[model samples]
Each structure stands twice: as C-alpha cells, then as structure tokens.
Target: MIGEREVLTRAQLMAGGLSRRGLVRALNEGVIVRARRDQYVSAAAPSAVVQAVRIGGRVTCLSLLQLLGVFVFANDVVHVHIPRGASRLRSPESVAKPLGARGRRRARLHWWPLSATPPAHSACTGIVDALAHAVRCQPPRQAIATLDSALNKGLIGFADVEDLFALLPRKYRVLRSLIDGRAQAGTETLMRLMVRGLGHEAVPQVHFARFGFVDLVVDGWLVVECDSRAFHSDWAQQVKDRARDLELAKLGYVTLRFTAAQILHQPDDVLAALRGMLGAGRRKPPPRN
Candidate 1:
C-alpha cells in the first residue's frame, strides 16, 4: 500500500484530533515514523527514504539507484536531495553528520537541488539518480555503459536523458557527450571503449556492404568486432561473422574479433593487438586525400 503524502502543518495538527504533544507521543509509541517536525509516516510503511520523499525532500542519486535495484557496489548511506531554498532536511543530528568508523568524512550528503525531476517508475528513481552521479565519477566510458544498461533494463528512458541534457548547465558539455556516446551496451560500447583505450582513432558501428555492421574500423584497413555470448551465441551468427571477415579481407580490410570477456578481463592484450594493427598500417604511406 502507498503511504500518505499529507504533511501536517503545526496549525493543522492543533486543529486535528492530535495536539503537538500528542503527535510526539504517537511517534514515541511506534505509531508513526517522524521524518521531520511536520512530516510523519505510518509505522507499517516500507522505507524511511520513501517517507522522506512523501514528506517533501526529493530522493536522488545512489539512494534512488538502491531503491530501484541497480546493484550499487558501494555507498550504503541513504542520500536525500532537497529542493534549493527548502528548509534543511530534518534528519536526526547523527544522520546529518558524516558516518565513519569514528565519525570522520565517510557518508555522503546529496543536498543539491535538481531544477526538475522526471516521473518515477515503480521506485526506479535510482536510474536518474545514478546517471547524475555517474557524470561525475568515471572512466567516462564505464559510466556510459552503465547508463546504457539502465536504459536497456527499463530503469530510465530516452526522454529522461533528453530532459536531463537540456537541464544541465552549459559547463557540463562533456557529460552530455558521454551520455550520448553509447546508445547500446552489451558489446557495441564495450568495443568502442577498448579501441579508444588502445589509442586507435576507430569509428564505431561502421556499416559495410559485405560485413553488415563492424564494431570499430580504423582507417578502412582494420575491422574489429566485439562478440558477446548474449548476441553472438548462435552458430549461424558465428558463421556469418566468419564469412563477412573473409569478404572484408578480400576487400582489403584486416578483421580482428574480440570477445566481451577478453576486452573486459584482459584489456592490455586487446590494446596491444589494436596498437600493432595501427603501427603496421602507419608503416605504409598514407593515401592521397
């Protein structure tokens, strides 16, 4: 059952059956969880964060991600994002301070106001929250991949990203670039990242008449394909890929295919192969423009 959003003002409580003291008394008796002086939740409600949002503060970032099952590896504290100019979120004094082994700077605080928020998806506010957080923390490529997964998993939508891109400041252009860099995850984006990491100026998702879709192509000489079991598991697709490789080779292109496990687990090997190809190509004279 959805909890109530009717926050009781001090005056409203006086007019209702309960007095200020009675409200406090009810809280102490485990009848309600007080999120703020005026905000209270039923004892049977689901989570403190939901109660906080219903009380007026916006839940965002890792807090939202955790609520939506995004598998955040770290960050256990709940983050509450309040609108700017709203009174400070009324958490217990202990919660307001940073959490630590001995109370040092450990727990994170998310007080920044988002000018706007997209609609929720059965508590999938976590996707938007994680996207906002990802912009700041990254090897940009990984963040892009995670965002793609969030979208593929139905955690967020394209409209939400467009809205966010429009809302973020002019100074954050790089974030917009990263957010738009990879539209699909699984293998396509992972290949782009590995190619870039290897210092190859590879164009991603290159379409060739004979090869269908090559994952990355460098100067029309080297074609790299990223294979993931989820997409390339079928024997037919493997055969098609091999036939395409031969066709591409006949057309004067060298094909190098790498599996997802190889790109992710043994990155240096992938880089070395790409570097070798680029170095070999550079040894030849450049074609006239």
Candidate 2:
C-alpha cells in the first residue's frame, strides 16, 4: 500500500521494483514528477498536494495554510515556490497528477529566489517563504489568519510585519493593517475581523467561568463559536459544544454558532445576523445570571 506521503526517490522507486523506464513513463503520464535529480513525488498522493513540495518547491498560500493546520477557506489551487529565474512549475500534465477543480489549472507556481538554496532533494519551503506567500497571495481575511497564527506561535511580531510588507509589492502592503495576533483559530481571525468591522469590539479566546474558553466575545457578552469540521465533527465534540452552550446561557451570554461553511460561503448572512443581534443587545444589557 502507498504510504501517507508520496514523496519518493528514484532509488526508492527502483527498490520497489520499478524499472527506470517505468519511472520515466510515470513521469510522462503525469503520475509523478522529478522533484530534483533523484527525488520523485506522486501527484495523487493524498488530500494535500505533495507533488510541489516533493519536487523541490515550497508550498505557499492556501496550500501552506492547509499544511500548517490552519483554517483554510478556499484552496483549489496547489501553491508552490519555484526558483525565480531557473525553476518551473512541475505539477503540469506531464509531471504530476492534476490538482485543480474540473477544467481548472492544478496549481499556482510562485517564482521567488529563496534566501538559502534548498538541497538537491528538498521536501518543503522555508517558514518565512511560506508565511510571506500566504500574506501576498491570499486575500485580506485569509491572510490575517496566517499572520495571526504566526503571531500566536510567537514566530512573528508587529514590527516584523512592516518589514515583510516592504518586501512585497505595494498592492499587498495593505495586509499589514489587518493583523491581530491574539486570534486563536483561522475562523476566529475571520470572525473577529468581521465583528470589529461593524463597530463592535470583538475579543478572541475570552474566558467565562461556566463556559471555560469561548472563541470570541463581542461587546462583552455575545459569544461567537466557530465550528470547524475537523475539530468538532465527532459525537463527543458535539456534546461538549452543547454543554458549553447550556452553561453560557446561564451566565447571560448569548452564543451564536457558525460553521466554517457558513462563515466562508454565506458571510453576508452571518454578518447580517450579527448586526441585528448586536443592534438589539446594545439597546439594553442583559442582567448578570
């Protein structure tokens, strides 16, 4: 059986009884790609795009977001960093399995000269490159999540943002303004930015005595819960969420639950509902429970 990873060296493939001709044929058929002189990565390895990283490119943008365990909203394109002058995107029809939606291109190749050259065989992009690409390539809401996650990990600072932004084109420099390092999840980053846009103070990872740790607290009492399928799809997780909701209600905190799908796809509806709730809540504060 194929392992979770699809990155293979020529020798490894040969050891598995594949002849050189077979390997070449696979490459010709787009079943794999030569990540380097010796390394080969399968196009249809698993859920994530291993082809780009396997073939000496660093994954970036929404691709890196997914790789880093961040909340990614849209990621149909596999993003990879190829050398600015010499490298070419390798996830093409002749090299690896296609990665895009039906009739769309498979991957996004970003040309950048890495500060340190990768080895003859490399598997991933540098953290800095991945982060920079995430900010430059993704939209403001999506980029904020990458920045906030970096901050939460203590990997970057507010001062560092301007410097990084300076390295990018002027168009992407606006990303520096939307950063809030206090965000916990990618969805929380998105939800906080959304609520704050409505002129309300939306603080993230707030603690209530009964509910333990809520995702976001808007205007001191309204709790916003962002549900991710990976984190909360199980029965036990659902029960815990229900219990948290029950306890928060006892403390006069009105909770609004939003799925990642709802937040990403039907944002206008979520925003409208939040606006309506905040409008009425501001009229009269609920008494302490």
Candidate 3:
C-alpha cells in the first residue's frame, strides 16, 4: 500500500492485495509512477517528495517542514536526507543521470544516518529525525524558530524536542531554553529573539480585553505584530489591524508592525530599529490593578 507520502515499493503493492496484472493495470492507468528501479510513487505525491526519493534520499529538514505547514525561514531548495554511505545517487530531475556537483547545489543534502526507521513506504523521514537535521541545517535563532514552529503546531511534543536536542551536538543543547511553543509564527519567534537579545523580556501572545492576542509585548508596553500576507494582506484586514493598534494605543501600548519580509530578510535593520525604539525614553504606563 502507498505510505503517508504516497511512496511504495513494488513488493509492497504486491503484498497489499494487488495482483501482478492489477499492478500493471494501475501503472497503465497512471495510478502510480515508477520512481526508480524498485520504488514507485503515487500520482498524488508532492513533486518535491517524489523528487527527493528520485534523488536517492528521503525528504527532510526544511523541505518536509514546509510541506507539513511548519514555518521555515528562507527555504529555497529541497532538503534531502541521504544515508551516510549512499552512492550512485541520481539527480532529482532524472533517474539515470548521476547527482553530480552541479546537481548538489539544486538540493540541500544531509548525509547522515536516520535517528530511527521511517515508515516502510514513506518518502519522508520521521519528524524527530527531520527536526534534528533541521536544527543542524539552520542558524541558531532560526533553528529555535523552526523547533518552535514544530512545537506550536503540535507536530512534536516537548519530550520529542528534548530527544531532538540529544541527537544534536553538545553546543546546541543550550538552545533548548529558548524554545517557546506559544509562538504563532516564525516571524514572532525571530522578533522575540531579537528583543531578548536586547535583554528585554519578550512576552508572546499577550491578550488585552477587547483586543485579541497580540503577537508580542516587550517590557509590558510595546506591542510587536508580525504581519504576513496570509492574514494581513487585504484592505479589510489592514483596517482591522489599524483599529486594534488604535484601541491598544488608548490603553498606553505602542505597537510596532513588521512584515514577514522585513523580519526574515532585513533582520539586522529590524534589530536596529527595535533597539532605537526601546531606547528612546518612552515611559511605561501604570500597571492595571
């Protein structure tokens, strides 16, 4: 039978009650496509997953996270996990051609042993293995954000995160303290890190009466919202955002809104602006009793 990612070996199909003739008929009907010598993928499998299997690897790291709707920062290439001793691998685009040096740049390859066995017919690695690889693949803050995204989405639990850290080298263990599952988005995690880097407490998803959850509150006064096109693109959403800002302003909260692009791409500039804003002598209002 086809696995979660819709990849199956010919033997698996045969064992799953498909007669030889049925298998042939299914292939002829385009129900499945031959991925390699012995591997077959369902027609519905994602192209990236199919390509990863074609490249002689499992889909993993940022690539798999993106497919699962987890936040990944600037993932421009497919991340493939090749076994430590893999050889004669093919390019993702071709089954017969070798994965030469040029093909290497087209995909990010993690040459390592899997932490655990994945589903027999799955084209992707298990979540823990993928997270371990993801941590190594990303920078420290972004790695935390990636882990936070996974935890926030309930893809993995705190114990799984601890296991992921155990799989990593010793230095990465320190990042465990920084993982916050409450982060609603990667941009929020990034901004929170920036604020924390400035020695400020960045409380996430703070709620005020009549104003839903704000993305972050710095020092109990400054509100930071990470605006993504998915939720804040239309004029209607913008108007609602403005109204929220105005309502919070009435309660003595100053809101700073940053686009996903600015937070992800212009991080240094964002940090500088945040530092200046926080340092400009703005007074905090009295705490509500």
Would you list the clashing residue pairs of candidate 2? 35-55, 100-106
Candidates 2 and 3 compared: the better one by lDDT is 3
TM-score of 2: 0.73
lDDT of 2: 0.70
lDDT string for model 1 (1-289, tens) is 1233233444655676777788778779887665555455456644535434443454555556555554333455545555557653343233343233442232334555454454431222345554675545445556566565566667678887776556545655564554433334445566666666656556766676543667777665677788878778999988988898878766767789888788777778877887777777453322311
Question: Which residue pairs in candidate 1 collide?
Answer: 61-129, 64-126, 65-126
Q: Write the per-residue lDDT of candidate 2 for residues 1-289, one digit (tens) a residue.
A: 1233445677778888899899878889977755545656666554344556543465555676676666556777677777656443344333453333531266677776654454444455555666777776777788888788877877667777766676677888666767888777778888888998899988788766554678888887898999989889999999999888888777677889999888888899999989889888573334543
lDDT of 3 by residue, 1-289 (tens): 4644867777788888999999898889988878777889887788778889888889999899999988888787789999888887888878888888777888999987888988777799999999999999989999999999999999999999888988889999899999999999999999999999998889998877686799998988898999999999999999999999988887888989999999999989999999998998757653521
**Off by more than 4 A, model 1:** 1-110, 118-122, 126-130, 146-172, 175-183, 197-199, 283-289
Which candidate has the highest TM-score of all?
Answer: 3
Structure candidate 3, residue pairs in collision: none
Candidate 1 global lDDT: 0.57
Top lDDT model: 3
TM-score to true structure, per model: 0.55, 0.73, 0.94
